[model samples]
Target: MTDSHDASSGAFDPASATIAVVTYNRSGLLTRLLTSISEMDPKPGHVVIVDNASSDDTGEVVESFRDRIGTTIVYRRLETNTGGSGGFSEGVRVAYELGSEWIWLMDDDVEVIGDGLAKMGRWAPRFRSIQGRRYDFDGSEFYWQYRIAERMGIPIPFAPAGFDESGYKPMNSGCFEGMFIHRDIVRQIGLPDPRFFIYWDDQLYGWLASRKTQSVIVDEFVLRRTREIKQWDMGIRHMNASSNAYRYYIMRNRAIMKKYYRALGVYQPVLFGLGTSLTFGKELIRLLFVERTVRGTSNLWRGLRDGRAISRDASFRTMAPLTESVD
Candidate 1:
């Protein structure tokens, strides 16, 4: 996938963009992210922080930023923990309602290290959706190689050597961390489904955006991870040791994906089934051999069972489109 559009026509204005950050109990990390946002050279006009009913001082952290961030900060605390998916869904909706032309979405774990917003804006005239690269906590480039297996309806890893002269790779998938998206695309595809609860939501949302307009990840280092996660280095790629909860959602979300693919008239049961089985096997292998946690298998199978039920439910087949009026 390649995009030949010229991006020199105009630049994106930071003032027109709204930064949306989703947080849970990570108040310290939230502070780090907010500090970086406060230091952005051309600060965004609005910042929306969605607190997923954190038990910590996450709300006070956002309140502290009110006087320091130099932007219109909107803080929303959900009554329940809806996980990353719900936090981002609400964040995007709030940002869109605020009349922001572009929305920058991320978690509390990453800090903007450079003019990532400015860099993303450079490609706004050409691409409706864009993703920027990030550095690991140790300062190495984080692994973000991804491509959508259209027939299988899932994102799979790909080599990172195919960047265009403009320093971007056209992608059918996205990561919520530092994703710069336009409001027009949101109107077309709707908010990220909250039911996903965590995994694969961004990939499906990105694929949906790509269907509307070209989506690309620019070769720009804009974020640095603040948290250190345990992972096994597999030479070619690194695999992070995921939690049991993540293991569950990772499998269960495959069912939610089928619903979206079917709505879009591209669901192939045989191929999707094959893909799901392969995914289950890969995760099982990773858990047993790589992560050395056989106990997580229960979560995996349970997720698969529940996911099968979700696939059978008629209500899960459709996504609600966002209102066109951003009023």
Candidate 2:
């Protein structure tokens, strides 16, 4: 990695960006990600790892890298696992407070390769855009845009067209893994919604950010990671094929976003709600009968009825209690 110096002060200059990685009970995977980040062509100025109350030796893994890595590494161990929303909320808040010009929000499981960060830094001069990795489950390479097309019930295209040597395209949605965001844009729009405990949290931030600035998908940046598998030990299969959490967020957040769109007089909420409900409802039914996970289905119903609410006294430490097992 190329190290630059501050001309006037004769001190090693910190990069303009900071990377915030949120992890829970994935110590091994988190270590790999940290190592990969440390080897980036242009190293980040700061790497903040938020351990979401992991019972394993996650703290030990981070400490191991304290001496080797050049960038400042700040490890904060939460008392509990506050889901993705809370973890991401706290991570981004800290990045902004530290005066980061840009924040790269990432999940622990994802790994970035090649000159991804350096390429992104080169493109930083272009408008403030939210950029994400082109990823697929396991080893398969798939366009992240396929999910958006599927959600909209549109035919999937073979590949993105009109690409130059630099891979760049207009994107409506993005995965949280390796998403680069400008600090100024986040300051104006604020943080991710903490109420969304699991799903759709990143989309909420992306959608809101799009209103004020542009959002893009950088094909060159690849966040290679496996698609989540429904394991028996994972307290809730938030991303499982049988869980209703996906449907619930799609319904409730669609409702919430529709209201915001309507207030801005941009689009009708009825159409958006109808589309989200129909798609998610089909998934919910499959989970109810085929998967037979009763708790997952029940949570869906509750989410739809309750809507999204921010509790006055909510905190990560409180939501995710320090327990031996999530069960």
Q: Give all candidate RMSDs, comma-separated.
A: 2.4, 9.0
Instruction: Give every collision pair in model 1.
Output: none
Query: Which residue pairs in model 2 clash with each other?
Result: none
lDDT of each: 0.85, 0.63
lDDT tens digits by residue: candidate 2, 1-327: 111112112222238778899999988889888888777777888898888999999999999988877688988788878888779888887777777877888888877675667767665666455575545545544444412442332113343534566567765454467678777666666776566667766765665556566566665644667445542222222223544556566545554444444444655445555565665565665565557655565656665665544112133121221122222
- Which regions of candidate 2 are displaced past 4 Å? 1-14, 135-137, 146-166, 226-267, 285-296, 308-327
The superposed Cα distance between candidate 1 and the true structure at residue 90, in angstroms, equals: 0.1
Local lDDT at 319 for model 1: 63
Q: Highest TM-score among the candidates is held by which one?
A: 1
lDDT for residue 242 in candidate 1, whole number 0-100: 82
